[model samples]
Target: PVHDDDDDDDDALITDAITGKRYRALRHEEAESLSDHLLSLWMRAGPGRGAELPVDSYKESVLEAVRASQVVVMVVITGCGKTTRIPRFLLEGQVRRVRRAECNILVTQPRRISAVSVAHRVAQEMGPALRHCVGYQVRLESRPPERSGGALLFLTVGVLLRKLQSNPGLQGISHVIVDEVHERDVNTDLLLALLLSSIKNNPDLRVLLMSATGDTQRLSQYFGGCPVVHVPGFMHPVQARFLEEVLTEMGRPTPPRRDREEEKEVAPDLDLVADVIDHIHSNREPGKDAFRADRRGRAGRCQPGHSYHLFPRKQLDRMAVFPVPEILRTPLESVIIQAKIHCPHSKAVDFLAQVLDSPDSQVVRVAVKSLMDIGVLDAAENLTPLGERVACMSCDPRLGKALVLSALFSCVLPVLSVAACLTRDPFYNSMQNRALVSKAKAALSGSSCSDHLVFSRVVQSWKELQGRESKQEFLDQYTLSGASLRFIHGLMQQFGENLCEAGLLDASAECLRLSSGLNQHSQQEQLVKAVLIAGLYPHLIQVKRGTVTKGGRYRPENLSYRTESGPVLLHRSSANRGNPDLSSRWLTFFSAVKSNGQVFIRDSSVVHPLALLLLTDCDLSERGNARPNHSVLLPGHSLIRWEFSPHVWELLWDLRTSLQAMIHRSLRRCDRRSTSGGCKDSELVALLVELLNNTDPEPGSDQEEFSTENIRSDRL
Candidate 1:
């Protein structure tokens, strides 16, 4: 609940004489009265803006639609004031009718950049005095409204979903405006489902969905055919030219038609684009020439401009009108966990079925199986203690679990850095200087055989630099983007705060105590790799050694690897791609992408066999007719196998059991309340740390010279 400092006996109230109901609506009336006065002053002081937008003309209609219906779908075009003005209209419309304390309005955007930029624009339009009423919130950053109610907030869809997890009723919020509904991303789709459920129990809540290019009829029907208002855009006429016209204008003859076999030999898209640019530059005036090619219709009419069509009209017509809903295309693990958190009694599949476009049943089942396999969900399909902690975070379930383990292992800093890096690419891969960037990354990796570690080292090195100029030099040297590094830094701080909120870290020390033993064995790079193995398990890859020449020379690129999917090579951008030898035969990766008919695994790191045995999900069985005592098999992967002596296997099994038990107990404690004292040291953690330290053999040591025959493969 928001704290109301003005709640006093002297505060004003409104009385409904007919119904005898005492309404606390006078505060909103006074606030609006003052707001109007300030807005008038602001207008007189400066040039008026936003009054000429197409949406401004329909403000009264929009307000009337909201007043008459439970839902309103505004089909406004781009460059209209719907995104900025509608929320204000709704808030002002509730001036004397609803209590000021209950007039909270939330507007959601599809992306963080859009949310923040729109919020800033709205604030500027509201003027300096009234700007406090408008603000925005996104992941890791926010400038929320200063007052409790009678204020508008712009936020991303994901942030709103997190709010729903804690406040299912959406207590004080009176209106929710979901912008860009046409995009139909996973978060927006889930939010719509949850909002529908919320509206059933809360009659005071109103929803306004605004989209420029969405299917208005379908959206109106989805909201039970409440009301639809269309606002025309303020479009300027654009001069459009097709490709044939462009070639005619350039006085260039069309090339002869090619057979199917020769089509692949056609000039590349970039080369054609370059040629077009050169032609335009040669023909256009010195300073007034501007040529724009846009895929979206709205972009061409933002102002009076010329639009060049690069492709044929038939090709444009054949393209899909709208994108597929993300819920159907992407994995549903996060969606399932969020649904389970919000609706505990309902099954994940049943809850997801209510979404606008629910995913396939098989996809849902696969996600559930994955959650259960990772110990996030149990047999009954309920969130476990670990799952509850993972739910509090805004990252993937696997990455979230890795964060929790990092806290337990007292290595929060390094793990947080790696997790933040995984969210997006931080390094700048310049097309012209690709070789230079790759060489710099390899140098930073320094035999670590870890692309993830390279990111952490970059951040650490940047922090160590004393001055701004030095930091800039360091970034330039490594071809890193300053903005991206700052984003990662902000994410690290935000994730640390999340850890504190989840009770994984002590809030009092602000993560300082979480690193109590920085100089200890837990701080070793190998332990960080262990945590990565725990999170990115099942993404394991088995390294296939390349043949060595008589002179002991081998090409690192010849080293092929196998995943659950067939053979894949190391991505060229990986730090480990250039290393001649790796510390272990098994490696864990962040993800794999297929390009040009070849699959490449990226952001990889070598993991000790012991880390795989203890951290990953695998089954151990006795070898029936082999000299090896026990054989390890990953549950779903049949191509990979590991063998060890019986004595070694028994020790590993016992250690794994103990580690699991300790982690469960620790997570339960975190769930109960914030652990201000931080994670207590345990003998099991110390033992595991020591074991991990010993697993990584020193360079040139005898332990690093194991023969290739020890690794058995069915394919071989």
Candidate 2:
């Protein structure tokens, strides 16, 4: 008999014997089983008090397939009970065949919303008595199963990957069901590869792949000829009307024909949709018209509904049968990092090649080069200590680096806010009143000349507000989304917890509070900006000064900036979009996008030259005999050069060396989970912060002595 006490304490740190790394252990309580009467009630009620789902009919087949094979594929249709019922089937089967405390089933969803909603629906169906056994986990939030076994856990793919980082074998899990494999997301694809490897070693483990629309045969072949189970959908008949049919029904003549060029543009015709809606509204009886809108291919299967297809049937048929997997379409840096962490011995390229759809070799090489350039991987493509810490985080590798550096610099609070904002912007821009939203953002930004800082300020101000009415008023005034702010807050807390798990921060609540305090120091803002530079290095933009007017005012339109990719305008939504009189010539931007044949930078910040000198990746060797100019060039960015006096350059070099050493030392301490040797270099961080504070020139100050110069590569 397995007791609940077999699970470790919530606060307990379990050390891995192989890597000698420590991580927080999960605590599970003994789950109370549902009463016989409650179970009878659930059976009588059925799913949502309806007839049995199509998936319910195939429950025995699914269970039998799982028992027969280590890998099973279920190609169920949408609206079937595959997402919720299949996991319950596996869990109950395991409970009856084995010890209830040893039956652990993990079902992976592609999105948090689905994972959470399905978990709630399943819990509701299971009755309140056994509700604790059904739970879900997503980034920054989770209601994990109460018991260690007889548990049906629903979690996002990314959450499961994070869990696998610590427990690669998934020691206690009996069945792993991956839902929505048709999504073909990077995480899902990667999860499939990892599970394929895991199943070979753990004969006791069963892997089930569920999808509504995917290449079933290909997935089965990838899983070594796995048994496939087909479950019909339970959706009512749907009436789908195409654009021409809708227009004919409405007795509206077609508009003028478009040119071939115009016909190639595949954007949705919103006007036609509105016309259809208006016709439906006018023709239908009062209160009889019901409409539902869903995106992608799931719209028609969302129940007994009428789906209006805006595009021609031929265009729909021309669309690819399956989406190009994210592994092939998206950047592979994060995937490569995770692959390295999962299989330390296997090469990243080799491991990724085993995926269902391997990325291009050139793309993989490029990702490896980026990781090496960022110091996350060595020349031999092995995970550096920094890489290990980065792998522990559930964020972008660059943002993870920023979080670790912020902790070392004692500026975790602001950096976390900035990272969260970058992950998901909290500011709301009303399409009706764009100017008002922009004005509100500019007012909040003040003279900081930073869109990133604007987010931090908004979050801080929202938190400081006293009452619900006050908070709502504050949000309304700033045009901020309260839900997005709450999400950012949750992400900040999650990041803090990740830092603790990485051993870079103390796990104590008091230490966490202090570390995440806003008023850490007088120069907290400068430190935060410097850390941003450290994280977003190579994303630097060289600012070109605009011509001054006769009144000594700078022309905003004349102001331009250039990144390595080429010239880019400030995004209209940025706080510094029209501000030309920036304090720093160098700007660090969060992201850039091309629109209308023009590139625009967003979420930019002005940083001191000293901060860039100390933080960014600079190659002294690139200077070589060019030292007479007392200038250094960033690797792969020869278009920009930083010129300082000989003495200043030497001073900056010494500071950079010391900072690097401190970071390495702190990482080592963190890896060892050392109590005596803390994860911060107090004196060094203080000196760096003070230098940044003092060196940051005020707006309109003539500080061109240490300024950066933009030179054409040909000139260099």
Candidate 3:
């Protein structure tokens, strides 16, 4: 519970004359009455520069539209003060006048950084009392101060979705503004659908959807033809150009993409983009035509909501209007599970299909089918016991599954750290310090191929540094953000608490013994990799015998062990990038994307093929071929061939089946009581570790071979 310093005084009580009820006396009432200072407080707590913004002219209309309807669509430009001022306007201007019901404004931002910074800016604009009035809630931090009377909450969309788990109707919040709806994440899309469904029962609830550029007509129609309001602001006109035109202007020929799949979705060519920008800077007068250079002579500056010229103009054309919706770009396992919880009686595909600007139908079908295969959902697309547990975890379904299995397998701490690192940014190295950062990362990795282990080492180093030096020194040495480290630490504690809350951890000696077995560094590393394999089996890849030239540099070709997406390169940030000897032959990756016209795996770990097969759902391929041609079928419809006798193959399958049953039983037994049951087979654990130890090490590629720079230059 959060304690308000202002309301903690014991000597500030007052008794009503007739009712005999005790209440805390107002702080201002000690010297001045409430009515005497109302106007002064209002002026201080309102918009700081209300006269300068275009939004001020339409403030009264915005309030009136909300009062008359249940929904409103706001089309505001980048810097029009819509995000920070609208909530304050509603709380002070309209809700105070009505006095029928206390109003609580909840604003949702698409990004966490925006949510926290906006909350701080709003609090600073207001005076002292308004400081307490404005609070923010994100994944790892929350300051919910006295939400009953009048409060302005700035939260990420994910937090609001979690709140809906308990308060589906959003009982206390009078109005909710879903900001940045154009950059549609899965959570934002889900929130819109939930609000649309709930508003029918909650006629008094008000919702405002704000975006810089959106499908206003379609969204307004979705909200029952809600009134649309556009607030204009000042912005410079931007020119667009084609890749060929820019390259020709730079006196260079167009470069070819590495493969055919890359043509579908290619990141902007940054080299060509930089050359074009330089040409523009040399040809035009800076003060009149473009942003003036700073003392450091960096000519271009990326503003908060404006696009930068560091990407191919063609790609910028698409991003100028909107970002690629996350549903189409990212894996949808967690989303499918959330949909199941929201519409338990309906099919997951059917429910997601109804969402506005619904994602690809084939994508939804594939996600649902994958979940069913993982045993999270049944054949009917209903949540199983494991699915319910996974739904409550604040992570991707795959990572959440890894956490659960880690607890059952007695390696929760390391896996918890890994999950936290994945959720939060642990490293913030800039291009100038890339060499030093790479060296430090290598030292932390301790010759492990797994980036997850490297992250754990970095976190441990940070903890050690906390006692010896200042935070600034640590940040400088590690090229990390201090805020990001604190956020990760908070998430670590929260994940531990969640384990206890889910009954997946306990005080029993047996459970403690299993977890304690991972005290040794070697033991911990092996178990962590095993849990990872269990979670991310089909994403494994292998080194193919080929070479490709990317950006005038040659690197070995990589292929997925299952899907065969070829010519993949290790991301520049990976610890294993420059090491000639990789830890293992096969690898498991978190994400694969085409950036800069090259395929790259973001975070990856090398794993033994035999170790991976242990976690796979083993079944014989359906073919009427000879015995030598028979192969084992794996998840994602992948097949693996090995030269083993039929008897030995049957024995391995039996062991895998046994391991699968033990994992299922242990997870099901984890309930509100305590985690007590798990496999205690020492020989099996030792054998799996031994197989991983005996695998041939992977040959590493050059770190500077490929450049995977971010194409989206701005975070608007």
Candidate 4:
């Protein structure tokens, strides 16, 4: 049987003690029933079409290519049957090959849609025993093969990475194929780096990397001169006479930014890409005016050369990408409607719609919409799969938070922390009523960091509301914002499901098991923090000593700076209003803060300062003294900066590693328990202790590291 961890090559299938019928893996009917809820989601689009053979007479080329070489690079351009044909080819290959080389085929995508859709299509095409030959593995669910011999596995790059980490470099499957390399996601890039570095050591491993015509050269070079087999698509090649040649020249005086923006449509080898695209354009179906390129590639008008073989826009989704400076392109009407509902008549609301949706709004607007569409908008009216995934993470302001949250799945309370992190932005505006926020912050400082003061104050007012049972009443009496509460509720639901999927159905089992019958006071507390920490660990930033503000008190940047002074709350008037209690002191949480006209959270994670300082970069020195002292300035982002220690650096490294390991251990133990159902409370406690121990450092000295600390506190 294919265990949850297929990486466990030696693991024997579970068997019944009495019957010895070798726990005859789940029956098709039972499996279907169990996954009925999940399948209902896909099936809801109604029954879709299955894979089919090409209408044109057969070309053994597709199947033959994969069969001949261990690793095959099939460059079948858009619509020429790459997606469908490739998986079918592998199934055929498995049937023909007899040796152990008859292992499963792993096909990975840059997004979830392709992964999920492709698997369903493949299974429908393959017919019966798909449970044994065709399967899928994505973020929330999996339909893996029972015996694992010939199944074709479709997964996302992130999932594959986790599988690799889980199995320490892909233990099972003999063939490894990577699909869609041009998308250029962080995860895809990282996976390539890992494979490239290790393929030599893994001779049994056959690597197949595929992509569009434009960027396949790099893949070839990366694979140690692997022979490339190119299959031209129906797309006709067109030459872009020149970028300006295709772009309509403006008669009126145009702004330079606009002029500059126009050129971005044809970037880098602009002339070349546009040329080929134009050729494909002329040869496209007479009436299919879809899948066109944009000024800079937004969900806007398609460029001319999309004729021959561009992915039809109407048929599928736009290849939406957000690499560096993310864009939040949204329809004006939708953003305006959302803003009006969020905070009617408020300037921020008006600005949220305009500045973010202005004609010139590219990075921020597109980023916001992309974030929102994918569930990055914690306060969205409705949630989508991508959005749900973002909401599934701990609070940070980036789109890539799921990775960190995924790590937490193995830890106790990962669900709780993920809920809290995703639900509330951890720094409330303290300056709105600087005095009131000051009161809340002061009420929170030290004193167990449990919000004894803030909770008591809020509860006192809340209790006065007599009918606090109502969500609105409870929110109003406690001075809680509706937006914040909305996020929390949604986050709670999403995290709950995540725990269930990870096999830790009883949230109460992890301490946060506060769901009534599974109730206990302060139950959700540690779990919430633990999951948040788990998701936010590697980004940890401990506060540096001696960094104090001019007022001679603690700066919220570091826990070390927090003292008897009690200045731990966020300022009210400042913009980036995050939660007060969960907000880091010496820790600077990081995420992809989309640059809308106003900056807002995207994908994010929260953790200690030391964690990020240690893992992502090294505190190198000219002669042993620290060189790049700030942790955030290490790699990927030169603009990100955070000041902290280099001494506990190694200690922070060990701590983050330990914390992650604990989460993994907890997951394995829990998964095993489903079959074993027994674990020591002491063992659970031990994992929890590893996460919380030594979280605090000496109150930092009076120094200031941040140029400006934005706040949103109690009053506003």
Where does model 3 exceed 4 Å of error? Answer: 1-52, 98-101, 232-324, 423-443, 466-484, 497-501, 506-522, 543-584, 595-598, 620-658, 670-673, 678-716
At residue 586, give the lDDT of candidate 4. 39
lDDT of 1: 0.72
Error of 1 at 121 (Å): 2.4
| TM-score (all chains, Cα) for each model | 0.84, 0.85, 0.73, 0.45
RMSD of 3: 10.5
Ranking by TM-score: 2, 1, 3, 4
Q: Which stretches of candidate 2 lie over 4 Å from their true place?
A: 1-50, 98-101, 242-291, 295-303, 508-519, 546-557, 621-629, 671-681, 696-716
Q: Give stretches of model 4 more than 4 Å off.
A: 1-59, 97-101, 128-132, 169-171, 196-202, 236-716
- Going through the candidates in the order shown, the clash numbers are 0, 0, 1, 91
Better of 1 and 4 by lDDT: 1
Cα shift from native, residue 21, model 1 (Å): 27
Best by TM-score: 2
Q: Between which residue pairs do clashes occur in model 3?
A: 541-561
Would you list the rank order by lDDT, best first?
2, 1, 3, 4
Output the worst ten-in-a-row residue range by lDDT, candidate 4. 707-716
In the range 1-716, model 1's lDDT, one tens digit per residue, is: 22334655321132211111222334556656655654454446452346566777787889888878878888888777778778877766664353544667889999999899988987887677767777888897778876545577889998888777656656557888999899999988888888888788778888999888867788788778878888887766656676667777878775555554444334445655667778767875543335444433543445665566765444456557887888888879988998998898888889888888878877898999889887889989999887888776778888888887777766777777788888877788745667988988888889789998888788777767898999999988888988998888888788877777777765524443333552133357887888888877777887766645569988545666788778788888888885768877778987787766678887899887667667665565545445655566655676555555666656667778877766767787844243323443456666677676654432332222222233223211
The TM-score obtained by model 1 is 0.84
